[model samples]
Target: MTQDDMPRTVRTLLRELDRASLATILPAEPAGWPYASLVLVAVDHDLSPILLLSDMAEHTKAIKADGRVSLLFDGTGGLDQPLTGPRATVLGRAERIADDRLKARFLARHPDAALYAGFKDFAFYRLTVDRAHLVGGFGKIRWIEAAELVPPQAEGLAEAEAAIVEHMNADHADAIQLYATKLIGRAGDGWTMTGIDPEGIDLRRGGEVARLAFDEPLRAAGEARKALVALVGRARALP
Candidate 1:
């Protein structure tokens, strides 16, 4: 990946990963220590990380006291030299939110969590990104401002995403499978699109997930439709 590809790589890591290490400041007596915990994550259309936490959780308590937090999305799994792989550290403030859309997005990415999502103590939080530090590889490190990393909101795309995902999963199952196998070269069945954004489409088949990025970023629902059609065509032509 070139330097120009760093933003895309960062978004891919954030979107594709199911879990991340969430670091929050300790609120106790011997305070100021960093507390890291495993957390499931999902991203909004603007790439903001969304999380679901119980009020009793340590991280949630810390956020109530001080919203500042960091999330590490490690993309180095299976690498013989872990440091040679790409990883990102997102610095942000986590504030509890009541948006139903965000909550649904988080649950869509982590369907198993739906069981407890309705409990009174569980609430959703969105990290307002300040910036991100990315290590693409040895000589490919950089600090990316939030503006540089996240694209401007694509008009109507966020609202249209769920319907688009439903249409593909319900009506175009074969094309979805072709995307996983023929396009991205993964051997699979039952691959369904969980989300779509200006950057790419997110696919899931059981526990495994995949990210299929577009050749170029799109700006609206119509453009996304064109891109998806074009992608399957390319996949079909590949021998």
Candidate 2:
């Protein structure tokens, strides 16, 4: 597949795989040849895999000895059928950090792992991605370069994000209801706009629902706020 097709496949892979197995190729021992072990990991904001390992763990020792590692994320693990979704492999070098800030970020998303987070033996390691191979279904496969795969921080995003949340929660209640009834085909009481960027806006309507993103780029905070107001007015005006 062409480079143009990689972004979509990578996005799909990201959405599909919540957990991955990281394999560290150990150095040759007295027995000769290396070995591989699987560890459950969470993906960070930068798409790097976060591993919580104890110093006593054999894999951790191996990784320290040789930083080279590969992570496998297979979406078909839970399915009974073979090759139901996509599978991806990420190649990178792992680095261990004792930074509290970085650890907090990782723990926020993987709260269940808190039990092990404070363990004296457990340390956090992040794999800095060098290359990726994404197989998006049977005939679709592509090699993704690190530069092209990661999303750059959106410019002028802070004010726009704040405005979106305020407008959606305050005056766009009915519009959010309409979004639920028309788009999601459900009845929603209230909505919340969590984050917004150049690509789209993320919204939550009633309960802890699925995230929704708008296709068209919202020009500015004021424009987006006005657009949402207009949308509600139109929805309420309709028969």
Candidate 3:
């Protein structure tokens, strides 16, 4: 869908789905491909799927031979209709992964899988997507490019992100107060900044909200640190 034609909630849901764990449909062993096992998948910053599997999984062996796969995941929830929930499906080519770095990222996001992470029988695979179908709702469907749906990487982003959350949740609890009272042009009751990204910071004010973006990119580690400090200061200075 064109950026203008896409709804804001739909866009947000797409991003969230990109970050969520995916389930790959693996063929069952010793039988018809009718049975599919659900496997947890990690998506790289580029929106490629990462799979950790056991040698015992019939699907893993099937992937080694065919190198083709499909993934499915739940999308955003519906407001008007319960049955019309959002969902997504991705078609891709799979490859076995032996890289330690990629494996680390996959494991980090799914630490709970450590129980089987180290078994010699387990392996990791990466999926290069060919196309994706995103269903925002019953009538809202769109095709998405893997690149357009991927997340961005900013240097020192993790540290900057954590610091922003800490400062906002700690010192400037009242500046959030001003966001609710003045910037939003509403009464002061409850407000806070919950998350930050390369684009901007997400603010929660009472039941209302806003997204504040930076005029320029925060490139280096030093720059990100300075930008976050300035952001906290700006919030604190608000009336």
Candidate 4:
């Protein structure tokens, strides 16, 4: 399948992003009209988007009253070349997630959130993707099923995220550098593996974040190990 036709490509774009335009129903509006706002976002293990919303924000209040929401992620190269890139709008319900594990994961991607993360007025909310609309440039547009955007996570994988990250960071740092520099075309030596899920692995180097998708989705640690090894082998052969 072409890149535009592949569901994994859509997921990878979303997973690699950190921001999106969030649209919510304005509760007090006569027509329950939509109100859009910019939100800092992170990807959860389940492939859903995580947001830290302040209770005082109109969008957050609207979300509490009505759970329905949508997030727009545009990979448009720039406003100067608007129609030449891809954009995806995720449709779902927003639900507050108080789990510390999730909060920590979100914080790893967005350390600035720590300033207000402990405040009573701010809380983490996850968008439960129900469907999506993707426009890949001019002629490539499709309504994607939620299953295509938010695929199933591996059993027992969530519990192993810490171990996986620790092992990669502590024992295989060089492999990460090669993966980032060679396979991802990133030039850096300080890259660290932050998170890995069924969809892909997340890498961070200084301020930049990179995502490395598996050739196929994996179900457990063994699969992750093999996939990672293969990726390193491929990266080694690139030169």
Candidate 5:
């Protein structure tokens, strides 16, 4: 398959995941070689990857020297049959971001990170994605340009995500439940709306994630609220 044949669901998967295998340039004597490591990740309002790094970590040291990197997200359960499931590689440059909201967004997804989030040696970095390669399965592969996957600037979303999420989780608890069980097919009362972007809402229950995508991308909080109402309408109608 080619980029033209790529499904929107694939992009949905990218937004749903919070961890990735980051490959960065090794800066020392192993100069020309690549180094890969697991990283906990989050997505910014524009869908770019956010990373929390420590100044003392090897990868962070390398990133400071050469920002260019790639993050691979795999979906085969474990790595037993790594070739059988869908995976994606994001190619980009990882630069430091000082946004407090993005940091909060990340902490919401990985609360344990809060322990070290304030460490003097730790900081946040956001990847400025250039392109992505996705392998959905055998013979199902494509290269996607960054623009096709990220949303354009939405001022309201960037500035008010915390309040928007609070409103949804507080007032629309039932709708959130409907989305988790009926629409996206997940179980448990632990369903919590972890994050929402122009493309979709991220649902987490006991730390397991499932994304509920909007029929179309949204740019404003009002638009997102309307989409939630419509989606709940459809979810209620489900037999």
Candidate 6:
């Protein structure tokens, strides 16, 4: 892919991957030290990374003290040479937020977190992204500004996202399954819609997940039905 296409690639990596390595500055006597840990992650409507952290965790405590952080999303799994695969480093400041829709989005991607999500010490935080660095194999690297990394604001669709996800999983299970098996070429049973955004739909069945991107983004809630129906037609027509 060219440098111009790196932004979309970064967004895909952020959306499809469920976990990342979170790096935070240590808040101690020698304050400039760096700490890294594994973290489960999800993205908000505008592609900002969302994290659920506990006040007791070292990273969380560090974030409270100094919100500046970096998250590494590695897409090099199973590759013979890891450096020859796609990966991204997102640099930003993480601040705790209290938004139900975003929390639900995170939970939908990570159902197991629902168990401890309500604990008093656990809270949600979003990365206020400054920029990202993408490494797409050899000779394919680029720096993506926050504006290019995230799509334009889609307030109408954001407000309607939960309802859309519920409606698809509730009333259109067959269509959703087709989307996974036919459109995305992933053959799996019990596939269901986990989240929907302007760019694509996130699907999961058991431990596996997949993303099916729209040909064109839906700018409003009213556009979703028509776009989804068109996808159904396209999936059905595939031989």
Candidate 1 lDDT by residue in tens digits, 1-239: 78778887888899879889999999996588899999999999999999999999999999999999999999999899998999999999999999988887787777788999999999999999999999987898998888878764568888888889889999999889989998888886788888888888888887887888889888777898899999989989988
Per model, how many backbone clashes are there?
0, 0, 0, 0, 0, 0
* lDDT tens digits by residue: candidate 3, 6-75: 4333334433432333334445444335335677655453456678888877777777667777676665
Candidate 1 lDDT (Cα, whole model)?
Answer: 0.89
Off by over 4 Å in 3: 1-35, 76-80, 150-239
- What lDDT is obtained when candidate 4 is compared to the true structure? 0.84
lDDT of 4 by residue, 1-239 (tens): 36546566568678888789999999885548889999988887777898999999999989989999999987774468798688888899999988877887788777777999999999999888898888877777888887666665777777778788889999999999998999899986799987888878898887788888888878776678888899999999998
Per residue, candidate 6 scores C-alpha lDDT tens digits across 209-237 of 88999998877778889989999999999
- TM-score against truth, every candidate: 0.95, 0.63, 0.58, 0.88, 0.89, 0.95
By TM-score, the better pick of 4 and 6 is: 6
Candidate 1, number of clashes? 0
Off by over 4 Å in 2: 1-3, 28-36, 77-81, 155-239
RMSD per candidate (Å) reads 1.4, 6.0, 7.2, 2.4, 2.4, 1.4
Model 6 — TM-score against the truth? 0.95
Q: Cα lDDT for residue 216, model 3?
A: 64
Candidate 5 lDDT over residue span 44-94, tens digit each: 777678999999888998999999999987766666777867888889999
Please give the lDDT score for candidate 5. 0.83
Please tell me which model should have the higher lDDT, number 1 or number 2.
Answer: 1
Tens-digit lDDT track of model 2 for 36-67: 56665655445666778889877788788888
C-alpha positional error of residue 205 in candidate 5 after TM-score superposition, expressed in Å = 1.7
Ranking by lDDT: 6, 1, 4, 5, 2, 3
- Taking all chains together, the TM-score of candidate 1 against the true structure is 0.95
